[model samples]
Target: MADVLSLKQSILIYLERSGGLERLAEDCEPYNDPQRTEAVYRFNVSVHPSDVMEVDPELGDCLLHDPLTATTLFQSACFQVIKSLSLIGKLQTESQVNVILNYTHLPPFPEYTLDLCRFPRVHRPVRPVSMEGLVIAITRVTKYTQGARFLCTNDDCPSAGGFHHIRVHTPGATESAVVRNDFSCTNCRSPLTEDVKFRVLGGEIISGQQRTSTSESHCFVFLTRTDELCNSMRIGRRYRLLGIPAHVHKWPNIACSVEANRVQPWNKVSASFQRLLRETSSSLWRFSAVVAHCFGLHVAPPGSYNTLKLSLLLSLMQTTTDAEDTFHNVDLLVVTTDTLIVDRFKGSET
Candidate 1:
C-alpha cells in the first residue's frame, strides 16, 4: 500500500526532503543582509495534459503525462510551506511578494504562486486605482537621505526615547541640522526612548515614457520608495506596480510619486550583457561584408571594403578638421608608444 497525504502535506514533505524549510526561514531573518538573501517570491502555474495522440499515430505519447503540467494545487502546497513558517513565528511575510507567473510551453517550471492578503489587494481589486509604467531610472539609497527619522532618550520608561540631533558630515564643516528638543512622546506624555531596528529606504523611482509627441501625450510618474516593500528593480522595463497617493517634499498639494508597495514586470527586457556584445559583433560583421562588396572595387561603385577602410584610415591619420566644409572630423585610435615589442598578438586578429 502507498502512503497518502494532502497535496500541501506532500509538498511540505518534499521541502523537508530537499532541506529547504529551515534554510528559507533563516534567510528571511531580520539581521540577514537583504542583498545576499534570496527573496521568497511566487508565480502561478497551470495543471493540464498536453495530448496529441489523434494528430499522428506515430507521434502519440498519451501514456506519459506532460512533465510540466502544474496546477493551482501545487500553488496551494507551496503556499502552505511558507505560511507554516510564518505561523510558527519563524518567517517574516512582509518581504515575500506573490506574483503572477508568465506561462510558457517549457518542459519544467521553477516558481508557483499563492499570494497573501493586503489592504489594497494586488491580485484582483475591489477598486480600480492602479499605476502602470516603465522604470526609466533608479537611484541608490543611503542613510542621510531618509524620509523621516526621530530621536528620544528616556531610559526609565519602556516608551522612553533618546535625544536625536540630525547631523550630516559636510566636506568643509561638520554641522548638525535643526535639533529636536522634545523629551516626551507626542502621542502619550511618556519619555522619548526607542531603538532604530528597522530600515527604511529613501530611494527615488523615475517611471515614464522616454519619447513622446505633442499629439501622442504621456505623463511622467515620479515615484519614491520609502518603505521596505519596494524590492531591487531594473530600468528600461515596464512594470505593473502598486502605490498609494503621496505628496512631494515642499509641495503638499502636488502629488508626485506614490509610496510603491509592489512591482511586477509588465514587459520583459533582455538583461544579458553577453547578448548585447553578440548583437554588436553581428552588426560589425555585416558592416565588414557590406563595405567589402560595395565600395572596395568601386567598379559600378562595387563600393569596395577597400574604399571604406581607406576612408577610415585617412580620416584617422589626417587629424585636421575641415571647419567650413566637413565641420566635424573623425579621430582614430593613435598608438602613442616609443617601442613596439613583438609578441604573439603583434599580427594576430583579436
Candidate 2:
C-alpha cells in the first residue's frame, strides 16, 4: 500500500510538473455542469516516458514494465487532481470517470523495438514493443466490453446496492472473460450480477502479420480505435506497429497476439534516395526527362526509348500522386507484338 501511494504521488507530481493536470481540468470542463447526461467522462492524457523518467526514474521504469498499474495510478492521480480542483462537479463515482493514458512518446530502449524475426525470441509479455511489417489481413469491426459494473447478488450484503465491483478489460483478456457472471463478491462471498446499463463498449479488433527480409511471422494485432485507424490501413501496405505482446488462450491452443497501441505507415524508400529525389525535384524543368532516362537505363539505352519510357514514368508518377491531384489523371497502355522486348522490360528493376 505504501508503494502504491508513493507511485500515485510520483504520478501526481509528474502530472503537475508536466502541466497534465491543467489539461485534465480543461478537458473535464464540459462535464462540470450537473445537468450533463453523459454517463462516462473520458480524460485523454498524453504521456511521454522520457518526461516521466526525468521526473522519477522508478516511476518511468514502472511505466514500462507494468503499464496497467502505471495507467491506473495516472487515472487515480488525475481523478484526485480534478476532484481537488472541483472539476468533477457531480461525477463522484469511479464508474463515471475514465482516464486514458496515451503513451505517445516512448523512451529509446532497445527492448522496445524488435524486428519481425526477432520478435518471437526477444519479446517480453505485457511489455510495450514495436514491429514493422506488411499488413496482410484485417478483421471486421467488433464490439468489446471496455468495462462493466457488477453488483453483489445477496440483497443483505452491504455492497449490494452500490456499484462496488467493477471489472475492466485488460491485455490478453477476452470480452467474455471480463463480463463473466461467475464472480464472487469480496464482502459477502455471493455471486455478482452484471448491470448491463453500466457496461462500457469499445471499438474494434484488427489482425495482421509481420514480415522481415529473412523471415515471416503471423502476428495478431488488436486496435481499439477502429474509425480512426481502419480506413487508413490497406492489405498490401507496410506499417510499423507499437503494441504489447501477449499470449491469448484459444480453445485448443494459446496464440501470441499484440495489443496495438499505435499504427504508423512505413516508408520503404531509403533516406539517401529520398534526399536525391528531393534535390532533383528542386530543378523542375528537366526532372521528368532525367527521371525517365534513369528509370529505363537498366532495360535499354536512355535515348533509344525516350517516348515510351517517358510515358511509363508519367503513368507511374500519376498513380503514386493520384490522391494529391484528382483532376490531372493520366493512364498509359503500351501495345506491341514483340514478346522478347516486353519480357526484358518486365525483368528490369524499377
Model 1: per-residue Cα lDDT over 108-194, one tens digit each? 221111112222222331111235555666555433323123444534543343223222211111112212234455545654422
Model 2 deviation from native, Cα RMSD in Å: 10.4
Segments of candidate 1 deviating more than 4 angstroms: 1-128, 137-156, 161-183, 186-216, 224-235, 249-255, 268-350
Q: Tell me the lDDT of model 2 at 193.
A: 89
Q: Tell me, by TM-score, which candidate is best.
A: 2
Reference-based lDDT, each prediction: 0.37, 0.69
Model 2 residue 282 CA deviation (Å) reads 28
- Write the residue-wise lDDT of candidate 2 on 23-113 in tens digits: 8878888776766644456666777888888878888888887887776887777767767778877666565556666676665667786
How does model 1 score by TM-score?
A: 0.31
